[model samples]
Target chain A: MTDHLVEGVLAGDRRAIARTISLIEDNGAEAQATLAALHPHTGRAHIVGVTGPPGSGKSSLVNALALYFRRGATGERGEGGSPKTVGIIAVDPTSPFSGGAILGDRIRMRDLAGDPGIFIRSMASRGSLGGLAWATADAVKVLDAAGFELIFIETVGAGQAEVDIARTAHTTVVVEVPGLGDDVQAIKAGILEIADIFAVNKADHEGADHAVMALRMMLDLDLGGTATVLHHGRLMEVVRTVTGGEEPPSQGPLPPARPSAWRPPIFKTIATRHEGVVDLATAILAHRAYLEQSGQLVQRERERAAAELETIIQQESLRRVLACAQGEKLAALIDRIVRREIDPYTASQHLLGG
Target chain B: MTDKKIRVLIAKPGLDGHDRGAKVIARALRDAGMEVVYTGIRQTPEMIVEAALQEDVDVVGLSILSGAHMALFPRIMDLMRQHGLDDVLVVAGGIIPDEDVPALQAMGVKGVFGPGTSTDTIVRFIREHLS
Candidate 1:
């Protein structure tokens, strides 16, 4: 039954695709069988992960991207009917206690719901440390096997753990907005390193220029190089405010910071208005082109596959080991650790060995 | 309080970051003796469905402050149908207008809880529907 569904999905039947995804999400025997049968058909799609700060308009951007993929000025492939289908995996964080997703990504991208060329799925992190749902990789695989042209995985921006997207997605987009304070510095160390494209959304707001400059400066410093030219536009505007004159002393307190080697272009956007989305998409495509040219696309996919395989093994092994331990034995082990009869390391070794 | 757990998945679909209502409802559901799964902000329909499946939840609730509810709810319903999860009750609460209620209900959403609705009302709705 599951194999039939998989075949139907591969044949571009929306009902079949929807059913297969549902089965996979349910993790039922049928869903597992469906995935196992469909695994061979996966890996044709390009996976792109979009993440950023909480209010960085990631959803709007994703919505706009989906729209473009569905109906672009270029008369490209329509969502489902086109030669390449698109799949979206929107990842939201789940509440530890209630296990529900607070926000819905599908609602934002509602316009594209009926597009035959596109398939979108929302996933919750389920209180996972990495801010990505455990099922995200598998869902992407299902979409790939089902013959999606592009798979977009959107996640909430966690400072450090966001690097996990690098391991899953072929291209990573880190979004930022204005008025986040000096938090950009914090994001720099964690997310900036992993981003192939840097988008500054809500550019209509004040301090957008400063935010862009700050990000550019951070990128330059990380790469250990200097920006060829100081960003005179926004920086000078700030200088005008500080000095209260067109030309202030060169040694002003707001002196421009030195630049770095990798200067990721800071594109401004009013994502809600769909402004600058085309450029953003262009940048994303360009980045993918770079990856392909550099042969990093294959390498990234290989690494992601290996990592996913390892994660599955670890998770299944842990589940089995924990399930095998009875309540009394588990309690006795904890007691031994408390009494120092054996260290936690030794106890785990013994339990695993047994 | 017989403690019959109402396992609910409170999901936010799309890019809207407003979660005050989702959080409040999650708390209310928890207080109502329901094991709530709150997928914190910016979930897609796929993610919500996956959570619903993994949690083996009885009710799948969504909070969409964004106006994209029209597009989002139906897709979820379709996914639910495809997965043969039509038995799992679908409900929504957020900035939904009165006009959208019928359409949402037609899409298999058993109930629509909008603003000004009390937590007790939501709880009772779930209890009533699930029962």
Candidate 2:
């Protein structure tokens, strides 16, 4: 059964792909076996993560991009390029109070349906805080193994928790709508570091220039430093006099964690109108090219592998420990820890028979 | 193995733009711990069936305020059959009248909810059928 399922998924069978994802969602032993079989055939597709806040046109942008990928930009053979098989995994939040979700990301993406070249699946962030379901990465792997040339993972876009997309996609595009809040908010968004490209969506709205400019300045500071920023105001003259224009001083005390040659570019877009979508898609492909050229592809893959390995090891170790600490024994042990008779670390060690 | 959460696709089909009842039922179903994929207002039957296939939903809740239930329900069911979605349980809600209930039920709508129907009743109907 597993072999047949694997064969079907590899052949890009629609029902098989859908069923494989359902199995992953179920997270059963059979599901694990299926994924294990499909694992060797993975890693061919370019994964891109699209994230932003609610009402930021994240779905529309993804829809337009998928359409562009499926039908091509010019609806023809060249320049905008040929159509590629695309897969999309769009996620919406599961209500914390209800533990169920209204996954409506497909509403805006209605245009892409019935297209044999595209497969879209909507996911609910089933208790996962990072705007992604626990099974999303595996689902992407399923699509990748199914021979999708490009797969887009659309995050739940739940603001701060949206960082995990960076862990899943080679390129993360953060969509921001102008005048969402204060202009300075762009500098505060943690997605700034995760973003390989930023689309200032709703660029037709008020303060689009300010939004774009603010994002530009933030990137300048993030990519280069205050020197790049200092080349602007009165700080330029002061810096020139301070260092004699030799090498501008550092922006902050802490340097960037991982220095990259790629600077995230910001594009003004009105996603609903399909404006700037072609440019955004081009930039995404360019980022993929850069990742391959600059060795960041292998680096990112290693980081992802290390993370997945740690996650599995942690789960397995805990499972093994729990096997020794049966129900009442675990409850009593927890009570003891609560009373300060023993600490949690010591209890864990005791369970491990260490 | 733990039981899978029931996945339901709540869609508003046809020319009806009024989706308040659909949303109410969707929220109620979610409250019962079912993952509901809502294809918002003004969805075509084809789109609904396509969504059902992609989402692999256990149930489909169609909400149509327009009196096109008789006109559209058969086509939706026919499409579902054509797409091999015959196993999916489908229910409907909206201004469906008492006189139309039996006909709609005969067409495999399973459940017909009218105005003033409690969301609990709808949720319970789905639970009972699926269980």
Error of 2 at A164 (Å): 1.1
Tens digit of lDDT per residue, candidate 1, span A1-354?
A: 876887887886655665565555545667667777888888777788888887678888898887776677354655334444578887776667665444456557755644667776666565566757666777787778877888999986565556677778877788888888784573435677677677889999998988877776664443332223222011111111111111222332533532111234567888778888877776776667766775656766676667778887998788788888858888899999999999999999977997
Report the lDDT of model 2 for residue A129.
88
Tell me the tens digit of each residue's lDDT in model 2 across A4-58: 8899999988778888898889877789899999999999999999998888999
True contacts kept of 2: 0.68
TM-score of chain B of each: 0.94, 0.96
The digit string of per-residue lDDT tens for model 2 on B1-109 reads: 4448899999998997988888888888889999999888888888888889888899999998889889888999999999888989999988888999998888888
Instruction: Give per-residue lDDT, candidate 1, residue B46.
Output: 75
- What would the TM-score be for candidate 1 when compared with the true structure? 0.71
Candidate with the greatest DockQ versus the true structure: 2
Clashes of each: 37, 0
Worst 10 residues of 2 chain B by lDDT: B1-10
